[model samples]
Each structure stands twice: as C-alpha cells, then as structure tokens.
Target: MVLILIAMQFYSPTKNISPGNHTQIFIKETNPSPNLKALFETSCYDCHSNNTVYPWYNNIAPISYWIDSHVKDRKKNLNFSVWQNYSLDKKDHLLDEIEKMVVQAEMPLTEYTYLHGNSKITDKEVVEIIAWVKQTRIIYQLGKQPK
Candidate 1:
C-alpha cells in the first residue's frame, strides 16, 4: 500500500491551468465591481474557472484526482472562463443560480473552505453578490451586452 501510494504521486492529474487571462471576456461582459471581482477570484474561481490555484496538498495522489473531478464538474455547470460562449439567456440563468448558491451558503463548498478558509464568502459578501447578480442580469435583459 505504501509503495502504491508513493507511485501514485508520480502520476498527478492534469492541472486546469490556462495561459493568459482565461476570464478576460467574462470580466468584460459581466462588469463586476472591483470588490466583486476580487470576491469571485478569491472565493469562486478556483474550481469554477479554467485556472485553479492548486494547494500544496494537490501534489499528492487521490487528493489531486478528487480536486480535478470537482473542477471538471463545476466548470461543466458554470465555467466563468467560457462565459463569453454562453447565450444571454444562459448567462442570466447562471447568474440566478450563482446568487441562489451563495445566498444558501452552498458554494465555496465546505470541503473547499476546510482547506482554503480565506476563500469562504461571508453572509455580508453573499448579500453583496446577490445585489451584483441582480444588477448584472439587467445588462443581459437589455440585450446589448459587450462583444
């Protein structure tokens, strides 16, 4: 078992790193305030975006695989890196879901916060995100989003 674990360390899962600003388009379209953008980067981007700031533990075997799986599932659900590719309606829907998850404290998953305590969003921040979501959706509703 020990040798197998040691061997596993040699084959870490492929990381989700993107060159340049993977979220540049998304940031341009959504127009989050500086504070909100910081919130998303610190709290929401690790798993939900193409670039993840992997922790040191991720160098280990099963933990790397587990973290990779979460990133895959989250990006599939709502990859901010590809926000530009989504239709306006999809953007609105995802914004709603983002508000709901944050409001319910279901995001920045506890398992994630357990390791990344600084990434946890507080209730006050949730309120701020909710407001930001409502305000941002209006741009989509107006049908004059940025190109």
Candidate 2:
C-alpha cells in the first residue's frame, strides 16, 4: 500500500507555461470584451490559456498529472490563449462551439467544479458568455477582424 501510494504521487500533473509572446500578442490584438475576458480567465484560462495559475496543491503528483491532461485536452479542442494564431474562419467556428458548450452547460468540467466551487458556471453567466461568443463570431463573419 505504501509503495502504491508513492507511485500515485508521481502521477500528479504540472502546470502549463506560455510557449511564446505570440499568444499574448494575439489576445492584445483581438481585444475581447471585459465581461468575456473575465469569464474566460475565471473559467477557461486555467486549461485553455497559455498562462495557467496553478494552485499550491497542484504540486502533488497525481493531481498535477490529471490537471495537465485536462489542460492538454482543452488546448487541443480550443486554445483561446493562442486565439490570434487561428484563421478568422477557425476562430469563428470555435466561438460557435463555445456558445454551444456554454449553453449546454458542458464547460468548466465537472471534476474541476468539484474542487473549485467558485468556478461553477451560473445559468445567467452562461447566457452572457454565449451571447458574447455569438457576437464575436458574427464580427468575424462580417469581416471585422480585431485590430
């Protein structure tokens, strides 16, 4: 049991780090709304952004590993931290997906919410996020790339 427990500790995940300044530049260029920015930072940034604010307990092995997996999966699906890198069409599609996920209450991952209770998405907040995502997508569709 002791050995097994020790082995489990090694399974913890590590936090993500920014790959480059390009992602920062991307966010600066896009200029998301204050509300949208707060929503993303609070709910999505940990996994989807280039800069992850790791909690102290994340230093543990098994938990850290799991968190790392979540972050990897999030980035694979849609990395808002690196948004500017995507083509306008791709970003628009991603925003549509974001709206869909938020509307369906399928975001911020349940496992995440269990620990970070405050990260839970409220229905009203979901509506706000979805609306913003749709608006952004429309902006993209209209050929209004963020300056």
Best by lDDT: 1
Where in model 1 is the C-alpha error above 4 Å? 144-147
List the RMSD of every prediction in angstroms. 2.5, 3.6
Which model scores highest in TM-score?
1
Clashing residue pair totals per candidate (backbone < 3 A): 0, 7
lDDT digits (tens) for residues 48-94 of candidate 1: 89999989989989888898998999999999999988998999999
At residue 137, what lDDT does model 2 achieve?
Answer: 71
lDDT of 2: 0.75
Could you tell me the TM-score of candidate 2?
A: 0.79
Write candidate 2's Cα lDDT for 1-147 as tens digits.
888768878665545876555246545755667766666777888887777878888787667777788788888988876676788788888878877877877888887788777788888788777667766677778885555
Stretch of 10 with least lDDT, candidate 1: 138-147
lDDT for each candidate structure: 0.90, 0.75
The local lDDT score (0 to 100) that residue 131 gets in candidate 1 is 88
